[model samples]
Target: MTSFGIWGLIPPVLTITLAFITKDVMVSLFLGIFSGALIVAGGNPLVAIINLTDMVAGSLNDGWNIRIFLFCALLGGLVGMLSKTGSAHAFGRWAADKLHTQKTSLLMTWFCGLLIFIDDYFNSLAVGTVMRPITDKNKVSRAQLAYILDSTAAPVCILVPISSWVITVMSIVKGSEGFDALGVSEFSFFIRSVPYNLYALLTIIMVLVIILSGRNFGPMAKSIAYAQETGNLYNEKYGPAPGEIDIDGDVNADKAKPLDMLFPIIVLIVSAVILFPVTTYLSSIDGETITSVGAAAASMSLGDAFNNTDASMALFYAVIFTLVITYIYYTVRKLFTIKEASGAITDGIKSMVPALIILTMAWTIGTVIKNSPADGGLGLAAYLSDAVVGGGFPIALVPVIAFALSALISFSTGTSWGTFAIMIPIVMPIAVGLAQAKGLADAGLLNAAMISVSAVLGGSVFGDHASPISDTTILSSTGAGCPHLEHVATQMPYAITTAVCALVGFFVGGIFLNVLAAWIVTLACFAAAMVFLPKILNN
Candidate 1:
């Protein structure tokens, strides 16, 4: 392996640091990308500039990035249109009217987050924006909202069999040499292993427990109390006014009807679900199957569909369906003047500008890492695994390490998909090899699978949840109307608590349960967190 020294690592580290300090995610990421390009180009000034431009252009042209941006822009437009039409406010007001209790409001938010499990990015943005007003009306803090959104996105996606993320992971795994040796079909293995993902199961349980008990701790507790006292959970800038429904002052207060909000949300969900089957069927034609990520990417690249007459054509059709349905609703309901609707879409795209810039930089960083001498990220993991596995540190710690390493890479590059792509192949083979060496080939395969998958999910989510350059985190803050760092600060303690408990669970299970150990540890951690968290808050 080649060494790029500390110089190779400096750009990503500086990006994250600056994001934390300046709270300007786009600026931080752009600087990170520029620095990486500078490193790659070295002393050639012209080459450095060209490298930067090419890095960004390549990223933008990537099918994955293009799809992500398209979805984001369209979703942003949908969200903005919903808000402007009074649909979001109307739905929020109606839901608030019906769910009189705080617990109900929280539960609804939790359920909504879970329901939007088709895609994490969509879940984070759409769920947070739609539910923010309702949560705020009921006095839930932005920290809590961010926590719910972040917690649910990756966890729920990992658990869901047909989600875009699972498809991507399975594709990566199937393509690996390890899977061929093991004779395990990617889809079947993914389905069989879902139950063993302790982090996903435990995190969901933990989120529900926090919601039901109203148990806030650390920064979350402070945030909740502050919201209750001031009636402004979204921000300190909004002032300490009580929940006042000023008919004239409320944006979109008068025009919104219950169905106006309900219809589009319902349509969005239905469209996504319906498109899944359509995309799958289309992908199966000519033996060219579209995985979840591929479907999304193909759907965004409609222009290609017109020429090639390929499976990606289904995606183009779905895009058309989305536009037509959205347009019909807007026009039939007289939601906005044609001009207003146009402006709303423009504003929606404007809101995504910052996200688009961050994404471009994130892609550039990922490319630089891939092309660098430290191409494979396995050195650190291999060293740690070798040092710890024989030292009797406990098997549970394996997943914990996986999670931590995954988190580190994801945070550095600000892309969970890239982290997953890099880590799965490197880690799984080592895990299987280690288990086989212990004369536990059968048990080794299962254990390795659990640990590798858990690590990937946990690490991917950790970075996505906390990193300011993370698109999901940024979108959550934007949706909740919270200052980005404020959301990060307020939610960090809760994430930490869950992480610590998860580590403990991994250990207990590893030493005792073997394959079932993940579940055993996860349940134990969930129970302990539920019991102890409230008391800690009281203290």
Candidate 2:
């Protein structure tokens, strides 16, 4: 789409390459963004620098972006306060006794990741923070914890219909061409596609299999072996982990109760669940005089409210409310004085500084790739989408092609939502047109559409799961106290294994036009891999 043609690939490629080679994400992202800006500026270095600054500023200027930034910082504060009060350690000690083994501890971590499925952002940060102390006590590597958090975050969010991811996905589905022709609502179509989302289902199953089988492989195996033998939870060569923050308050280990930690996390989760609908309702009446939640709720169904909700705003409100309640509760418990608590909160915010910087850079670089050439971007998404749409694959390969294409775009761009926005529009028409050309009836056409859509969703998640520049991936590392690149390095093999299985399933399913056949083959591939790949790779 851009005059730059293949040049659009330079930014993300450079960023990812430098990240792997130098292991400095910040510098890599900056150079990547700078390169893209230079291309957009027609090789004017001065203009590129100015454009770069403005682009990052533009990303932060969005209300949603700012809200997410604040939410992450505030969540860090809450985690810090819990740690300062010794509540996190107390809960860890209690959980360690009950869990009794490394396997159970990791399983509990996986379970917690699944339970907090409302939002991937919240799921990663909250679950990792709450589960870290326990995982650490059990000697599970931070890379492993981060992988679970990263794996569960987007994969679980995309699979669950009642999640932050669903609203975006449903909206995309609704606007997609030929979707209305099917006479099926977006929500129903989404539900139907869930069973076809082999990557997510298989990735989730892979997590359980890895834990239950205790068969680690690839870079992950080395990390696990290192942790088990050296008693070091992370690779020390990567320097101090990203999420390690020092609290200014004295530890209250002996006096702290596990409830001190559990109650706040409960409140955080419950409040988020309740506030999502409430915030959606309120946002719909932003310009009106409606001041009451009751009035807003009376006008629409709970499902409607959730579908229309502003997830970032809802989470922002949830974390703020939790912090308030937690402060009061900690005060009542005499965990710390107001001044000490304030210092802990301040230190917690400081801990998030690195994460904030990485996210900002990631957003800016994404902007660089997404913006049109005239607007000082490489238009990478457009370029990639155009290429895939023009590829002219066989009709039966649409589902698998969509899955692989979506993964490439998402990995290159570092944003799954952006991938959905681009791919769904492009994939829908292709799949529908291909089915009609094959003289398929309504049922066959619908099957093609659903499979393609599910493939896009799953593939998008795969890229987001694996990309180092992805926000969820960075947040997972921050949350789990792992080095960012270490998480990516360790998780890629597992993500790739699941993706390969999903690809095989989509390929066979595309041929048969059968969801059951797809699922069976996917499971079969995963099972076969589980029996063989781990042993081979670990050896």
Candidate 3:
């Protein structure tokens, strides 16, 4: 009903601009939400404030959003437990001795992120908690550490077949006629799409380029220089004062063993993995009311198990289990009293307060912008994208456009999963129609569908990586104990460079429709960009 159309982009634009100006993300998000409410309420200031309050409260009511908030709190407590037990310190000391250089320290962090491929939330918090001390000793700026943590979080998750991202995408792709007509399973389609996901691939690879080359251009370079030269891990302008970000555990380090920390973390990870199936199985049982265990097990493979899996519940229950395990183990070891364990949980959850607030604000603005059409809010973005695709946008350019559009939406909204939800339905049907109109072979049509899917996944991840308001981005900064704005400003340059290279890859792939040819050329393009862009930017 609000016919703002393309003009509806103003709210997000204002939000981003205000963040840089005010240097306060909360105020910026509030202003952005108010701007949208103003448009919806036809410029009535009082009604706009009312609308703002309602929508923000509504964002909290959504189950997915609440789950994320609770998850972050639990993850914070876990990190605190590790810190208090001196687990992170022991590992940090061991790693620092083995790594002995900035590049190696960074690589260790990246590898840890990659290893935790099950979920992005786990990846960001876990890697940051474990690697923070090593990176700090190696003179890596918290911003650089934040960038590494973020780049690996979503990008690595998207690239793997066995991750939360894959499950989400498969659910979207399962109902798509484009993928269905191709005569392949949704999971296979997702796997096929991985190679074409240029944004994700480039992002993962670029971390190495930044590390090995040591050509840190842009704000990141300045940050690293300041840290390496002065032994200061954070800059004065964007970084918090030294003591403000500290969440170190409150216990003596003399008696702490690495196992005190490692045991609980291991339980948490394994429990999460096992419970994914257990949770899904229980749901299926409730829905089907099956008496036969064999029948229930068979039905689980309809590929709906992942969809049925309650990720939040599983995570919550798993972490709780780990805490129980930790409490017992630490008690037996006489490392800390029961009171101390409770204190660590309290301290950890407290540390995550800033991140939770930022995430909630970001989600509120996203709700205002992406509310359903029937809700009578600003739904202009989808309309704007529809116009481009429907106005005879070329078939060859579909993947490229899909990638770019998805990136823009995800960037503005600060949620990759939300971006995927919006783009998958829009782009897939177009990809199919284009292929059919061109009289493509079965293989070619399938290829086209896969390309479109890949574009959406890649673009969403890329945009989320760059967006300051993104949950993963916030988590990365929080985990690194870096000032969030500095993390955003420093990583923007690196994310943008990889995204540019990926754009070219999508464009070329769209033009030719040959996966091998496009991949070869794109890798070359990425290498060239990585080699030359730094010199160009440095100059």
Candidate 4:
């Protein structure tokens, strides 16, 4: 790392500010990357441009990065194929007739997101793809649909014990020595933190409040109102246009069966169920083959199995399984000519180009901050940990401050997992030290540590929901066929509302050493914000 120092913060700050002002995600991200390169290149404009290319190349070439990109792209093709076979329209018509109201449509989407708890990526793309048509027909805006897709994604994943998120968090926390002092398992500690993870809990709460109340505000309100009034679900400013998620122009709607959509989705879910364990067993293998489920479970604890699993690779496998099955099913039923299927696949991959570009740029900018000699990257994290310690903030407020720090970094980086990589290591050690020094009881110390971990997780997800360049954000837009910037505009008010409540909840939780009370107040705050803020903002 170079000696760039505090200047590393410039890129993300600049990106957010510019994106808000420009409403142009692509240029905002590129400029953010360029700014980081400029600082890292010692202000030499030419060198910075050259550094930009290298940084982008490095990010795209990364194995994990490429894996996620391919997964999104391949899944995009599946969506396109669904539309091409006229399954989306048939399904939408059928869903519209059944749901009969906008509230049910949105709630159904939210419920689906909650059910797909195995992985966040799966939750996002799958929910968006499946629900877009239904929601659109019921007069729900793409922005609103994207909001539900994103809100329920990482937030739901983090809460579920069997998810990749839980497995990862457990692995990291278990490695910390603090839990030894408390005499609790990492999984147990994480479970206790659930009530205290204000943002995640409140986000889901806010979604329900918005849906059940049948009220919305800000850009989202306008979008929903417009859709209801005009039967035009897309706002032109925030997207490439809304019909891309629709049927091919030449398709015969009558030929499309709802099963054309349901069958593949079912296959994808099954593949994920099968692959999660197989991936775990394989990754956990030292030198021997795992011949049976019983043997695999015996060899590793559930948490350990998940920790060892490669979620990205496993997702890749799921997408491939879905694509192969979907295409073959279509061709076998004579629903698609070989040429039509091939074209749909090509267009589907093409549709993901915007998201892929944003993901690459976001990844590059993250590297600029982390790897740069300046204080903005890894150095920034270290510096902040020291600053937080050195600051005279009370022990009870550590969770609040940690939440803020995690949010900033994740927002800047556009990756919650990356935020976890940086913030968890810092917070874990701090928790152990603080807990030991306070001479706190086991429950008290556990409470403090849980707050800290939960803060990081909640804040990372909130920030990811807010960030324009975020992968889930892009995918949500792609799935809903909304404009990328429009999704950001509509989503920010909701995310920030939950975040403000969560921040207050953390402080209250710390003060009273009670999680349940904090959750009640947090959800209440979200409810008030939803009812009043929209009215105030609309006025």
Q: Best-fitting candidate, measured by lDDT?
A: 2
Write model 2 residue lDDT over 377-486, tens digit each, in one string.
Answer: 77675665556556755767989998998887678666676567556755776677667666787788889889988999989999888888888999999989999888
Regions of model 4 farther than 4 Å from truth: 1-3, 13-17, 20-52, 96-197, 207-248, 288-297, 372-378, 392-500, 509-518, 526-539
Clashing pairs in 2: none
**lDDT of all predictions, in order shown?**
0.61, 0.79, 0.73, 0.72
Off by over 4 Å in 1: 1-42, 63-65, 113-203, 213-255, 283-320, 371-398, 405-493, 505-516, 533-539
Candidate 3 lDDT tens digits, 58-135: 767876557656766776676566656665555556666788788899999887777666557657776787788788
Per-candidate alpha-carbon RMSD to the true structure: 7.9, 6.9, 6.6, 7.1
Structural similarity to truth (TM-score) of each candidate: 0.65, 0.66, 0.66, 0.65
Judging by TM-score, tell me the better candidate of 3 and 4. Answer: 3
Q: Please identify which of the two predictions, 1 or 2, would achieve the higher lDDT against the true structure.
A: 2
For model 3, what is the alpha-carbon lDDT of residue 73?
A: 75
lDDT of 4 by residue, 1-539 (tens): 44355665577667657755665556777897798788767789998898788877877786666766787688768766765776655655666677967789998888878876655655676567668767766778888898999888888988976454565565446534345666675545776778878889788888988898867888888888787787878777654753454334477767777777678768877787678667777665555576666677788876666545666667688889888988889989777899888888898778767656755665665566545264323344344434445654466777888899888767776767655644565576566556556677778878878888888998888867788877778877777788888888888988888899998888777676678867777777776786689779887
Question: Could you give candidate 1's per-residue lDDT for residues 32-95 as a string of tens digits?
Answer: 6677666666657677678778877876785645655566566556655655676645656667
